[model samples]
Target: MAKKRKVDNLLALAVLSTIVERPMHRYEIAQTLCERGKDRDMAIKWGSLYTVVQNMAKAGFLEVVGSERDGARPERVIYRITDAGRVEMADWTRELLTTPEPEHHRFVAGLSILAVLPPAEVIELLGARLDALGRILEVARRELGDLTGTLPRLFLVESEFGLAMLEAEAAWTRSLRDELIEGSFDGLAQWRDWHDRGMRPSEVTASIERGVAEN
Candidate 1:
C-alpha cells in the first residue's frame, strides 16, 4: 500500500496565516509570527520557518512575487499565497479543528507498556510526572491570568485548551496513583501477576483478545 502524504504542519499554517495578512519575505514572516506571539500557539524555529516556506513554494501553495536587497543584507524573495494555498490553508485548518487524528503523546506511550514495570515503580514514575505536570499547569495558569486583561479570550483559546488538558491529565493521574496505593484498581492483580510471572506470548495475546471481547 502507498503511504499517505502529511499536509499538516504547524509552521506551514503559521506561514500561510502570515501570508494571508500580506505578502512578505521569509524574514518578515518570521518577525510577524514572533511579534504576534504565534510561538505560544505553535512550535516555531527560525530554520524550520525557511524550510516550510521553500516546501510551500514547491507545493505551489505560494509563489515568489519579487526580491529586494536592503543595503548589506542578502536579497530576500517575497512570496504570496497562491489560490491553491488559500484553499489548502482553510481546509487544513478546518480539518485540524474538527477531525480526530492519532497523536503519540509520551504519557500514552508510557501507559501502553506500563505492565512491563512493577506496579510500585510505575506508580513512583507516574507520581513524578504528576508533579512536573502540576508545575507546568501552574505556570500556564499564571501566564494566562496575566494576559487576561491585555488580550482577548479569542486569541488565547489554544493556551486555554492546553491548560485544560494538563489539568485533566493531572486529575486522572492522581486517581490512578491513589488506586495503586489502595490496591483497588480493577484488573491490577491480573496485570501484576502476569508481569511477575514473566508473561508468555500466548498469555499476552489472550489478555488482548479478552479485553476486545469485553469491550
Candidate 2:
C-alpha cells in the first residue's frame, strides 16, 4: 500500500531527483527536469511547480539556501534537498520499485465498455490503434537504438521498459483482433447478436447483468 505523502505530487520527486546533484533555483529545476525528460516519465503540471516547491519546504523536505539574481530579473531562491528529503526520495523510490499499483488506463476503460460498439467496428478501431502503435514503436526503437552505445544502460533502461510495455500491449491487442477476425472470441456471438437485433446499449447491459446474476 502507498503511504500518504506531504507533497503527494510526482513533480516533487522529479525536483528532489534533480536537485540531489546540487542546490538549484526553481527555474533551473524546471529546466533540468525538462532537459532530462522527467515530464515523459511522470505527469507534471508546470504551473504547480512553485506551490510544490513551497510545500516541500514547509514539509522540511527542502530548504532555501540562498537567492540568486540574474541581472534585472527577479531573485530566485536556491533550494537544497534536506536530509529528510533524501530519506523520503529514497523511500518513495523503493516503494515504487517493489510495489504493484493499479493504474486505470484509458484503453482499459474503453475495453471495459467495449460492448457499446459492434465487433466489426471494434476490430477496425483496433487495427487503427495497432498501426499507430507500430509507428510509435518504430520511432522509439530508432531513437533508443541511436542512444544505446552512446549512453550507459542505466540511463536508457526507462526507455527500454517503456518499449517493452508498448510491445506487450501491441501483442495483446493483435491477439484479440485476430480472435475477433477469426470468430474465435468467446463472447463474440452474443455481442454480434445484440447489435444484429438492434438492442439498445442499456438493454444489452441489463441483459448482461441478469445473466451474471443468474450465473
Candidate 3:
C-alpha cells in the first residue's frame, strides 16, 4: 500500500482556515501566521508550513487560483480553498472544540509527570508567560475599545468575556510564580535524573504519540 499521507492535521486546519478567510499566496500566509502567533510567541516553521500547504493542495483541499509577481522574485502561487476544503475546515473546527481535552502532556500533565523542575525555573517561566499574556490582554482590550461603537453587542460581550479569562489566567500565573519563588524549590536536578532513568522506551514513545495527538 502507498504510505499513508501524514501531515500535521491541526496545522493543516489552521492553514485552510486562513485561506478560507481570503485567498493568499504562501508568503502572505506565513506573514499572517506570524502576526497571529505573536501573542503566543510562536511562528509557524516555514518549511513545515509550506509542506503542509503543498500536501493540502495535493489532497484537493486547495486549488491554485492564480499567480502573482512580486519584483525580482519568481511568481508566487496564490491559493483558494475548494468546497471540500470548506467542509473539512468546518468539520475540523467543530471536532476540535467538541473533543475532550487530551490527557497527555497537557500543561497539567507536564507538571504532574516532571514535577522535578526547579521551583525557581518554573516561576521564571510562568512569570515570562504571564508577561506575554498581559501584553496580549492589553492589545485585546485596546482592540475591543476601538470596536466599541462599531461592533454588535454580542461580539462586544464575547470579547469582554475573552479578556476577562485572559486576565484571570495572568493573575493565576502571577500568584503561582510568586509562591514558587518564595518557596525556593530545587527540584530540577532530581526531576531530570528521574525523567532520564524512570521512563522506558515504550513510555517515551507513548508520550510523544500523546503530544502529537493533542496537537
Candidates 1 and 3 compared by lDDT, better number: 1
Off-target runs (Cα >4 Å) in candidate 3 are 1-7, 33-42, 103-110, 113-165, 170-215
Off by over 4 Å in 2: none
Q: How many angstroms is residue 100 displaced in model 2 relative to the true structure, after the best TM-score fit?
A: 0.8
lDDT of 1 by residue, 136-200 (tens): 99899998898887998887888889889999999999999999989999878877887788887
> 139 in model 2: Cα distance from truth in Å?
2.0
Sum up the clashes in candidate 2.
0
Ranking by TM-score: 2, 1, 3
TM-score of each: 0.82, 0.95, 0.55
| Candidate 3 global TM-score | 0.55
State the displacement of the C-alpha of residue 116, model 3, in Å, after optimal TM-score superposition: 4.7
How do these models rank on lDDT, best leading? 2, 1, 3
Better-scoring candidate (TM-score), 1 or 2: 2
Off by over 4 Å in 1: 1-7, 194-215
